[model samples]
Target: MDVPAGVLGRLRGICLGLPEAYEEVAWVGVRWRVRTRTFAHVLTVEGGRPAAFARAAGTEGPCTILTFRSEGPELDVLRRSGPPFFGPPWGPEVVGMVLGPNIDWNEVAELITESFCARAPMTLTRQVERPPG
Candidate 1:
């Protein structure tokens, strides 16, 4: 199964909107990168092809997975959120989210923005307008 067009489109809008961010075909799916650093990646998992991701998602069936960067309190929160959220077995700061009809696009936008900032250089990150905390 492939990533749904609407979900991919929404991700494109969020990820590409970042300063100097670019999209490319990843090993299994699509990834958005800032320079050489990938900040966001979306792919479909099926038949436990990617063992780690399949296990983390707790399913062998087809499912869309989005992996992105996170840190500090946010990372901790997402890691403990369970279900739709899981800690991908890669970078310590990398977080994986399961995409479905119930996903909150606004939250995905926010997470993608944060991931961009984490991977982008200071000069580029400074140009992004983030919500006041």
Candidate 2:
């Protein structure tokens, strides 16, 4: 379950707005942020189980923390067996599919980068509010 360094670098470069962390071994995690706010986190490697969490911006607050499965079928079984976590409406769910088994690491990295960009706040421009009379 080891991803190449070059792949990781490309992903990070695309997400310069956020900080991405890879290769934490058993507890490897990737955190996506906007300026200083956290938008999402992916637990790439875990010794105990397979799970992940994502956070969306412009919401009431931090989401309830939806759980996602990695490696396809394994995650499916985990969900069916009454796991502590559940899936969230983070994406089309095709991400894990493209990454795992399919061996499409490049596509996976690109998808992740796109997701981060969509989640991250606009680095330019500001919300214009009209002055109350």
Candidate 3:
């Protein structure tokens, strides 16, 4: 319960707000999916990042990693944002953001929404506001 429920709840709402969205626990945390395809994954590791990820990250675990779907230019922007956002292990098309009290829920929601849109089918994607360009 160290992490704020508000933060988690906000993320949950944004993800599940999408069409056919659902939640499942895995990788020691919860992941939101559209049908069977995961768009956002949240995990708080108590012992630094997992070994596999640490290699690429060059950092230990004990961090909250929230990975989401992102494409080239947009993905580049997130990775460049620094601190809270970074590249996840072995994923060219995804980004992982560190979660904490200082995190911006609005920005988080936008990222998760885009992630959902990217993974969800056209029929489902059409349901959301489509955010901004």
- Best-fitting candidate, scored by lDDT: 1
Give a tens-digit lDDT track for model 2, residues 1-133.
3334454454455445333322222244454455554333444332322333322211221222222224346435533443233434455332232123334445444444444444445542122121232
TM-score of each: 0.95, 0.35, 0.85
| Model 2 regions more than 4 Å off | 1-7, 17-28, 50-98, 101-106, 123-133
lDDT of 2 at 99: 23
Candidate 1 lDDT tens digits, 81-132:
9979988767789999999779989889889999899889999989999866
Expressed as tens digits, the lDDT of each residue in 25-109 for candidate 3 is 7765788998889999876655554665444444575666778999868988887777777776577888878776687788888
TM-score of 2: 0.35
Q: Mark the 10 consecutive residues where model 1 has the least summed lDDT.
A: 49-58
Top model number, TM-score: 1
Give the Cα-based TM-score of candidate 1 against the true structure: 0.95
| TM-score-best of 2 and 3 | 3
